[model samples]
Each structure stands twice: as structure tokens, then as C-alpha cells.
Target chain A: MDKRAIGVFDSGLGGLTAVRRLHALMPQENIIYFGDTGRVPYGTRGRDIITKYARQDVAFLRQFDLKSIIIACNTVSAIALDLLSKENDIPIIGTVEPACRRAMTMTQTGRVGVIGTAATIRSGAYEKYLHKKDGTLDLFTQACPLFVPLVENGRVHRGDVVIETVVKEYLTPLKDAGVDTLILGCTHYPLLEEVIGDFMGPDVTLIDSGAEAANLASTQFDPNEGTGTTQYFVSDDPQGFNQLAELFLQEKVDVGAELVDISRY
Target chain B: MDKRAIGVFDSGLGGLTAVRRLHALMPQENIIYFGDTGRVPYGTRGRDIITKYARQDVAFLRQFDLKSIIIACNTVSAIALDLLSKENDIPIIGTVEPACRRAMTMTQTGRVGVIGTAATIRSGAYEKYLHKKDGTLDLFTQACPLFVPLVENGRVHRGDVVIETVVKEYLTPLKDAGVDTLILGCTHYPLLEEVIGDFMGPDVTLIDSGAEAANLASTQFDPNEGTGTTQYFVSDDPQGFNQLAELFLQEKVDVGAELVDISRY
Candidate 1:
């Protein structure tokens, strides 16, 4: 029964979705979230830069006496999770394994589609993970690079032409491949869930990796006594944080975010 | 007649447009272009972070014996140019002033439109510059925050629905406003010049700020004896640099890029 806050970090506002799910799952657990909003969309960057940013993000979180850490970014999880986990003393969890497990249970057919940033799909982390669980599973992978931009710009609506067109452009491949389960590999993908779901139709199960990771964290590390309060920190756009979160969470959240220079960490 | 290279930098590939024009305008002048591709899309972050990044970007370029510096990024031009100029001994040129002077000459209806990153438009840099040029001029400004991502993802070509839809979404307001001249305030916007021109029609002259800034630099600094060569550097994506440059330039480019860690500066 630990009292230290759970540290959760993402490249940007995507991790707030994870925080939402985690908050719902364990109302008594204290949470600290770090969103590197200044240097986001880690999906489009090189592995070396992603690894460097991921380390700095974790280092910032480590400033707190954290009970555990969650890497809500698929790019970080794919590129640097193993290295981060190995270095950190406490339990360090990434979105990949939990999301892979969730997809396995949700898929009736062996066919599964993974959509994420370029690095995530390029790394073959999801394919590698699921194959070890069951070699017979069929996987189709696509890197929806523009999805983060679409979501970041608040184009995550059903009827918006840009979002709809981009979603169709990316998901049509997975849809045509006839995969019944789709993994929203990047945390940002969940924000565009409605547009993606509408395009993919009702039969396809969309696995929210960040949410799944939050659920996994809820099961593993128990800081049994906590205040249940959530503190948010971002590298930039502190004023826009609450508005962005409310856009994703669908509620008026009065939580104020403190600006932290993650680069200094 | 300085022999030193003219240093040009952007948050990302956008600055390469300035470099392209500079290379064309002054073939004998040595040029150093730095694109912070590792942490691109500086348009959305807060002013403090942008200032920090802009300083670091200039600092990286300052490592070379530059005769002059060009801030090809409208966000940096809008937010950090004055401060950067004051801090450095070399003459500093930003996209805003040169583009403003060009737009003043092109506007037949005394109506001009400016489109760039959110930070650029929000900075009101263009508005202030144009107003100071001619107070009676009718000005319309729009923040096309998604333009960089669209360009970065290689969506600059015509007939692509995504780019068309986005262009229409951003430009329709300016078109309806009856703008006679449009400023491509961000470097990334010039890559989508064809689609933008197609949408805005023939009469509306589109001003490429990066190109104009490059032209301004060409006039100011001679750099008399160079090898007629250009060297490229990026914080990330060394492999993708030439390919991206080619897409924007419409030529087969073979210049290999060297990677630099900009944050270290």
C-alpha cells in the first residue's frame, strides 16, 4: 500500500485519455500526468530523437517519488520502452503488451489490424508481441502519420470532411484487408475514435491502447491509500490543456495545468 | 564580400524552401540550412517554448561563421526575430518584413490575406507589419495550423482530396473576404503553392515569405567566394531529408543531410 503518485506521460494530450480511464478505474489513486505538448507527434520522428525525448519525459516524471510509470505514447513504447523499463527501478509499463492482449480477446477472427505512427508500425513491436502469444494470428499494419495532426487540430468529428477523408484514406486499407480488430496504436488515435469507428463500421473492435494500458496499470501497482486527485503538467500550452482534455473527455474539467520545461529535465 | 555561409533555420523542413530560393538566387554563396525535424511543428506551442527553441535553432546555426541569419519560420519570425536579432552580432532577417514589402507592391485591391501557423497569426506580426506599411490596407489573417503536418506528410500535390479539402477550408474565408494578395506566411505553405493558387485563382498573387526573405538576404550579404555548394543539417530524419526536399522542389535532389542534436545547443 503505497501513497506515491502514479506517473503517466505521453507525447501530448493523448495521455489524458489514459488518465481519464485510469481515474475512472481507481478513484482513490493519485495520478501525475506529463504531456510533452511542446515537442509532440513523436510518431513522425526518428528512433534516436524519440528515445531521447522518452528518456527526458521519464526523467521529469521520476522527479516525483512515483509508485509506477506508464508510457502512454505508442512511439515511445515501440522505440524506447524496453530501455526505459530496464533503467527504472519501479514498475514501468508501456501500452503495447496490454493493447495486444486486449486485441486478442476482442478478435473472434485471427485477423488483427494495427494502426499507429510510422515508428510504431515500422518497429514491428505489435506483430512481434502478438506472434509470441499466438503464432497463428494474422496481422495487418498501417502507419497513419497524418492522424496525429488531424486529432491535434481538433478535427475529430463525424461529419468533418478533412477528418473523414483522412480516416477513410488510412482505415480503408485495414478495412479492405478484412481485419475484424483494429488497434489504435498511438494515444492520439483514440481522440479520432468516432471518425475511425464510423468509417470502419460496427463489426470491427477498436482497441484503445492507452486505455488498455491504464487498466493494466490499475491491476499491477496498488498505491492503496491515495487522495484520488490528479495533477497535470505540460511542456507547453498550459492554458489550452483543460480545453483540450475536455474535448477528449467530453466534460468540463476545471483542472489547471502547470507549465514545465521538460527539456530542462 | 563575406566568405562565411549565410545561416538559415526553421522548426523543420519549411526552412528548406528558403534554402532552395537562396541556393537559386546566390549559387556562389555558401549556405547552411538547419531544420529541427526532431521537434517540428513549433506553430502550436506557447511563446516561451517557441522562443527557447528559436534561440537554440539560431545558436546551432551560429556554430558556423555566418555573415547573416534568416528566420524562415513565421512563428519564430513573429515571436523571436527581434530578440534574436538584438542578441546576435550578424544581421537577422525574418519572413514577416520581406513578405510584407512584397505584398504591399502586389495588392491591387489594397486587400491582402495572411495564412500561417497559429502562433504566427496570433502574434499579429503580419498585421502589425502591413498596418505600419499602409494603415488603410484591408488585411485578413488565418492560422492554418495543419499546413505543416500536411506538407510534412507529403500531401502537397494537387488533386489530392485531403489537401484540397484542407486548402478550401482555410482559404475559402480569405477568398470570400476578397483578398487580392495572399501571404504564404509559413515556409511549409509554399510547397502547397499549386493547390493554393488553384483554389485562390489567378488574380490573387501568393507571396512566399521564405523566398522573399532569401531574396532579402541575397541583396544584403555577398559571401563572394563560395564553392557554389549547399550543405544540409537536421536534428532528425537524415535519410528522409533529400526525399522531402525533392517533393517540395520538384527535382531529384541527392544532397545527404547531417544530423545535429539541436537541443544540446
Candidate 2:
């Protein structure tokens, strides 16, 4: 049984949601996480920049012996996954395809709503994967650009009027389209599930893309008996990441984080 | 007669406010501006990272034959100005000192309020400069972390509900302190002048830090007119910057923009 650590990374702290999911699915697998807090919110950036950053992120993770890499950032998954997968042999998993597959199965009606960062929505990666599975599926996509910052700043509670207002602004059109299954296309979006759920009402089923990808990764690997450990690395100062990481992961990152000059990779 | 272009750069499009000021103050001076759009919002990042990014930004601008360089971003000015000044023989101007000097003159009650990004506020650069000028002056500082994103997203209108709510949340304490002059310490804040002015009322005279810096830069330079022209460069794609640039500049950037991969420099 190969037991090299799984490398998971995001533009920022949101990827910890995927780590949380992996913990539930495979408790004995080692995880190495890198968050590019120095240059974050990849959702708003251009495609080339995202690809370059993703390449750097993967290269940084490759410093350690890694069996696989999981791109927990939806923006990177949408824009840079194919190129990144080809660059390395370690089976790279993106948060888009597995999520599309789950949404395909979960939908009662053919209608599916997708909400994510501007780049993720713009990439049309989810639609491409969803259409590949079933040609007849009706897809709706919305780019909620401000959601990441709102969630990152801890404005994601159930009753935060500001967040609720923003949720309504983004989800009302999707709700009106009568989509039965909605994909929380960005990992950070799941943090606002309560507010999103309240606005979308009980009829729509929301899929956490990061969690689905984590589950897919867990199923692909063989779990080892060694105690599961998490190592955290960030491009920014460790203190800032440590402070905000609580909002993303259920458990404290057992291994304290260290700073890395991500540009070198 | 100095005819070389004056180089000004910011973490993002916000620095265009300074360019706008320069255009008005010295109509016959050629200007070169670089915005690190791919890695924008240096205000949220750590000091060393900001310094590194600022150095790269300055280095990128140095590609042009520049007479002087303006640190139009308050975060960079607050954290990286001295280092950048030491590194370059070109006269380096920062936003903090100019704005503080203006506020010292504008405040009748000696009660001044400052609002900016977390890094800018944390640097305490404004307070330090202001205290050095007049030790008895009262200062109230608040870090409005969300303002940059809100402005960048074009949510800066006077009656925009989201921005108004956030403005109240951030400025109420400053108002309560009975401050007569408030410094719009970050360049982006000037875009929200209407909303901020509405919230603070006419009495709280707001000092635009970027404008002050631009004015300072304009005063220092001797203008020799062939023809005043503007050239723009960005770390990300030119298309994205071109799209959002109208929000910052009074007139269209006449020379258009070119993309530069900032990491190389």
C-alpha cells in the first residue's frame, strides 16, 4: 500500500473544507495543505495567471513526496486542472468533475444550478463536464464574485443581513429557473450554506464540490494505519492563516503551519 | 527640463486616482502606471510579502526611463516606502506623509480619523507622521478591511445599501470621537467618497491620500511639455484592467495598456 501524503491546495484558506471532508472519509491518510494567502481570490484573476499560480502551487507541494494532489480551489479546478494533470503523473483531482457527477445523480429534474467565483463560472468547466455525462441536462450558472471575501471575513452566519442580502441577489434567478439540484461550485460557498439554503429554500439540493472531490480522492487511495496528520503551509505569515483557519476546518490543524516563499516553486 | 515619464504604481486599479490627480495638476508630464492586478490587494497581505510585491512593482516600473516613482498604494507606502527609497536613487514619494501633512492643516479641532486597509492601519504610519508633526493632535484609526473589495466591485454609489451599511459599521466610532478631518488613507477609498461623505456628513473633511501624494509628486517635478501622455501596464491581462480602468481615470487611458508578467522582474 502506497502511503505518500495527499497534497491539497487552494488560493487561500477555503481548501480546509476539503481537508475536513477528507478527514471524515479517510482518517489515516497524511495531508499536506498549501494556501496562497499572499496572492488570493484566484476567482477574480485571468485564466493565464490562475494557471501559472496553480502550477507554482503544485510544484511547491511536489517538494514533499506526494502520491496525489487535490486542487480544492474551484477557480483553479475550472481553469487549470487539465494542464496541471498533464504536467505531473501523480493523479491530480480537481473539484469540478466529481461534483458534476454527484449533481447529475442527485438531480430529480434535469435542471441544475451552478454558483461559483467569476473565473469558475466563466470557465464553463462544470457545464462541459455535466453535459458530457448527459446531453439533455439544462444548466444554469451564476458568478457570485463577492461571496469569497464575505465568507473569509466571517460574515457567513445564518442571519447576517449583509450575507443574506447578497445570497438573495445571487440565487434568486437560479431559484426562479426551478433547478432541483445546485452545486456549491466554490469551496468557500459551502461556508454560507445556511444563508444560501435560507434563500434557495428547501426545494433545492446543494452539492459541496470540494467535499465531493475529497470523497473521490479518498475512494481512489488505500488508507494506511499510521495516524492521520495534517501539515499546513501558507505563502503569507502563518499567524494570519492560523487565525482564520478555524472558520474552515472543524479540527485544529494538528500540525502548526509554516511560511513558504511560494514564488520560488 | 525633466521630460522623462513619472512612474506610479499600486497593488491594483486604485492608483489610477493618483494618475487622475497628476493629469489635472501637471497636464504636460508623461506618466507610466503599473498595477499588480494578478496579485492585487496588498493591503490584506503580510508586511514582508507586501514589501516583496512592492519591490517587484517598483522594479517593473523601473523598466521605463522614469524621473521619479510614486508609491500610490497606501499599504506599500506605509510598509515599503523607506526600503524602496533606499533601493532607488529616483525620488520615491509615498502617500502617508503627504496625507498626514494635509490632515494636520485641515483639522481645526485637532481630532483626525483615519480609515484604510488592515496593513495600512496596522503600520500606524499616518499616526506616526501626524504625531511627529503635532504631538497633541488626537487621532482615531479604524481598519476597514472590506472597503477595497467593495470599491473594486463597483459598489461605491452614494445610496448603495451594501456599501452604506458597511460605511456605517466602519465609520461610526470615528464619528463618535468628534473628528473634524478624516483621512481616506487607502487610494481605493476615494472612489467611495460619496458614500463616505454622506455617512460622515460635510463637517468631516476627508483627505484623499492618493491625491495628496500625486500633488506632492507634481510639485517636485519640473514639467517640460512635448506632449503629456499616459501608458498603462498590468501584471494580469490587459483586457481585464482596460475594462475596469474607466472607474478610476477621468478620461480613457489614451495610450492603452500592455500585459507584463510581474513575477519575472
Q: Which candidate is the best by lDDT?
A: 2
List runs of model 2 lying over 4 Å from the truth: A252-255, B252-255
For model 2, residues A1-265, the per-residue Cα lDDT tens digits are: 7789999999999999999999888889899999999999899999999999999999999999999999999999999898998999899999999999899899989999999999999999999988888999999999999898888888998866678878888889999999999999999988998888888889889999999999999889778665788899999978988988887886655447899998898
Rate residue B186 of model 2 by lDDT: 94
Full-model lDDT, candidate 2: 0.91
For model 2, how many clashes?
0
Best DockQ among the predictions, by candidate number: 1
Looking at model 1 chain A, report the run of 10 residues with the lowest lDDT sum.
A218-227
Quick one: best TM-score, which candidate? 2
Residue ranges of candidate 1 with Cα displaced over 4 Å = none
Q: What value does the lDDT take at residue A82 in candidate 2?
A: 88
In model 1, chain B matches the true chain B with a TM-score of 0.97
Cα lDDT computed for each candidate against the true fold? 0.89, 0.91
